[model samples]
Target: MNDFEFHLDQFMLHCDAKNLSRKTLKSYEQTLRLFQFFLENECKVTEIKDVKSWHIKKYISHLRDRGKYTVTANENTKVYNHPDKRIDLGREISDTTIANYLRNIKVFFNYLFQSGDISENPVKGIPVIKPKRKQKELLDPMEIKRLLSAMDVTKFHEYRLWLGVRLILDTGCRVGELLELKPQDLDLKYNAMLVRNPKNNKQRYVYFSKRMSNDLKRWLKYRDRFSDSEYLFPTIRGTKQNVSNFEKTLKNIGDSVGISVTPHQLRNNFAKYYLLNGGDMASLSRILGHSSIDVTMKAYLDFTDDQIRQKYQRHSPLDNLKL
Candidate 1:
């Protein structure tokens, strides 16, 4: 292998040794491979030492112009039947996605520099890319009610999904973490669950409401009759729940209720509603498994004018004071 490829492999090995999540490792590989392809074909620079800041800048431009899904690292692996194959093939790539690519490349180069494998970091001179934050749409209380009411609780699968949705809304736990939950992870006495498999691989306690605690009691009894799986939300076959299947089921249920919803939307709604109901940033950050308060603030601070007014009315000094 060439010097560039060899270095890339070493960086991946380092990341693996550090126990980075598979999704994170995959993203790093994809971004670096694509960058390497660009360096070789566009700049005719195969050596790792030959890459410059200008080449990286040119790559950013190339990414912006190339559009989404127009290029892949391995063309042979492209699945014809995949849903993403037809999605916005030539549409302009979002700045957020391009920024992610740059971030991944920067991380790889930073690893090389820190390891003393490279004399200079090509990515060090590149300006940090901060994409404009998009406003995340949240489900209103009425919409959430409709979503929950649409599920038929008589059926085992629907009941499971219904309880799952409620748990997510109540606790703000991620879908992946929820799926990894075992019965032992729950503490109905304290109205909380231990998130053993969070995105950052750090375990934390996520709390729920008393009403949700009662619902969990009911779900556990019902779940016991159908399956003996170790996972809290297992399939009929007594296996762990699939994230994609759960997502699709939620989406289908939302469609039946004349609304759009996803596990992420439920999590976002939880954060939004929590802030609206006077939850503090630090507590919210910890509950959401965010690394810092800043991360939580940046995510949920884009409140609408109506939402801001609601918060103001609730906390307004004039209204709260015994005037």
Candidate 2:
């Protein structure tokens, strides 16, 4: 009923019209609702026009001051008077977390300013926060081989697991994309598969290696003999496998090998190896289904010094020239 509440609803409607992903829409809704709660409960400002930069700054400071224990949905009611969501508490939240909250606020305010809901933009002067990058762990060739060799093909899901992991390494398709694949999506002859529903909601092609092609052929024969699921990788009940199950299986494998492994990590290894072996950025962008080359570059380009050194020797002009 409040001006801020009405504006927040309108902003969500705009985002929905733009066809933003459900996950993104949920995040935006949560962030904005939390802001609304803060405005009403903390600042006592029911009107959108009454909000100021200091109010926004105070909210930011409040976020930082809150300790880092996770607050459940019930706990959220005590602080924000908004039920049905949990929040982090206890230690100081990460720079990345604060940045995301600030970014959401900026977006909401930008919408309000564009729609003439507010005369001044409170988020205009806030500097963008750049979080410190952590070096991502990658599996080398031998480690990758060890994982593949450890798979027990006699077990049906492990067979699926083996092929699934290899496909990710070979093609860099996301685990969600891999799990969503159907039989018709594959083209073994071309050593490729069609990603019909990638993160960007666009169809893209990702190619596998000849080795992976062979594995797919074998798995297909075995799969047909066992179950009749439409999915490329299905469970014993002939239903699509859940991503959580895949992650759990991967974790067990990682524990056995003494190297923590994740689907994203495998995908990361694929990108790193692809680049080190002379794969182009534009192609990698398309293969990974990123919106732009810049998106792909920003995500997968953070190579460690050792990784850079390894890549350099293979491509060094002097070494290649054979002078």
Candidate 3:
């Protein structure tokens, strides 16, 4: 087999072996196509062996040149830190999209080098340019209530629509983790849930109130009657539901109620309220299924501060005594 074909097969097989997601595979495919196109059109080369570092430099230059345009890289790489300095060539691009493209290109080139298609990988020296990660906004209690109330419980789809939001608010579970839940995973006697196959392949138990147990009992009763309710949170039509559809349902419920609520926000609210109501940091961490108490403390530090102040003001022994 030819070098080009061999490299392609090796890289694709590696991607499959790693169990990369479909979305990631698509991005890799696009990057490889772009690399081939650059070699063909930019360098005026017909063969893969003809590709060179000069060609990659030109690609970076092309990206930088786009930043000079009105509606280009500048829009993507907004100077969140400095408004005056707009030159990306001298510094770096803050656009996650551009960084991804560059990284993908480098990975493709590295794969070619490993497959014996190239003598050296030019991308080896180039650093992975990362962007500023934006802070996620947590949805407020009113916003969550609005979204939950807007769902029309009369319809099967709508009943589940609110249930998804409520479950997350009541129990701080990721959307994928929540959907991955099975009917038997819920432990009512313990007031806890076993999150199987969690992030990093770690299994953890999370606890909730007696109210959650009642809610689960009702949901389980309804679920057991259905022929296709093997999963804890089944689809409206009673089949396994995907996270995307569940997300869309949350967004739709928000639109109907005139409030904004996402799956992350729902979980955030639970953590937020849990901290607000005098919940211990370490215990809340265990209930949220967080690997570290540091994560729980950091995320809800403000809530803890408020809780401490409230308790001090309300239950201080000196308050009952005469001054």
Candidate 4:
């Protein structure tokens, strides 16, 4: 090709023709442009096909050195932050953003190398930097209880929306997994549901207590009022729903219930609470569809202490003897 822009345009065309989401295409384009700029200005290179891993590495490093950082948007901007201040305003990109741009850059090269546009895979050895995730903020069971009970279930809206709250607390599924459920995914007899397209496309079964089954039964009947929905929890419209649709409502419920919790908090709480009450990590991992038990353990290292203590209480021989 003539220039980096030419390859980028073709890459974008491929992405669109393959039906990639617009957001995904825009991200690919944005990061490629940054890469192009980096190549021409910093590395004195002009073509993406000619670029090597070292060139890409130096580009990311160059961006970092240039004080690249992304500001986080304030969640409650109208209440706590100035609208103008909410906009990111600096050279500092966030760890996540730096990672994304890097990831997209790698994809660009992989596309080039595989398409015979490049002789060697520049990104073959390049490692994506993973920023240590911030500690998970999880609510305690009582906190969740306070939040759920705080909801006036008699209110029609609250009752209808209760399915979202119940599923999170009971199964510990991600908001995406919870919202992605359909009529076909449920098994009321076994109190199980199949959660598909989880993180990394991992699919797993999540079970609920009998109470959850019963509550779901009630909702399944009334949920049609939301529109004769095929999805276990359909969007306001009959079409497929996005996770954003219900997150705000759940947050509001938590606020009303006197707990500072997100859907994620409830998920962590679900794992933590069950494991606290003699639940096994392996089973919990399966229920949550965690690819590894290590993930569940890391997320709830503190809860494992409780499990250990309970294990001794139940299995220790001395416990049955008179003191």
Candidate that scores best on lDDT: 1
User: What lDDT tens digits, residue by residue, belong to model 2 across residues 138-190?
Assistant: 88778888988888989998888998998898899889889989989899888
Write the residue-wise lDDT of candidate 3 on 135-156 in tens digits: 4455665666676677887666
Residue 23, model 1: lDDT of 81
TM-score, cand. 1:
0.93
Give candidate 2's error at residue 77 in angstroms. 12
Model 1, which residues run further than 4 Å from truth?
Answer: 80-84
lDDT of 1 by residue, 1-323 (tens): 99899999999999999998988999999999999999888889888888888999999999988887777887765765342666667899888999899999999889888989989999986888999997878888899889989999999889989999998899998899989999999998888889966446889888888999999998999899999999999999999888989999999999987998889888998999998999988999999988899999888898999999989999999879957
RMSD of each: 1.9, 3.8, 8.6, 5.5
TM per candidate: 0.93, 0.85, 0.67, 0.72
lDDT of 4 by residue, 1-323 (tens): 55787888888999888777656887788778767766776678886667887887887776676653332222343455443453454556667778998899888889888899889989998988897666555565577567778667776556646668878888888888777788889999898888885444558777888998988888877777667777777665666557665677777877775666677777887887787667888999888777799987876665445556775787567776855
lDDT of 2: 0.85
Give residue 173's lDDT in candidate 2 (0 to 100): 89
Comparison by TM-score, 1 against 3, better one: 1
Q: Model 2 misses residue 118 by how many Å?
A: 2.0
Q: Of models 2 and 3, which has the larger lDDT?
A: 2
> How well does model 4 score by local distance difference test?
0.74
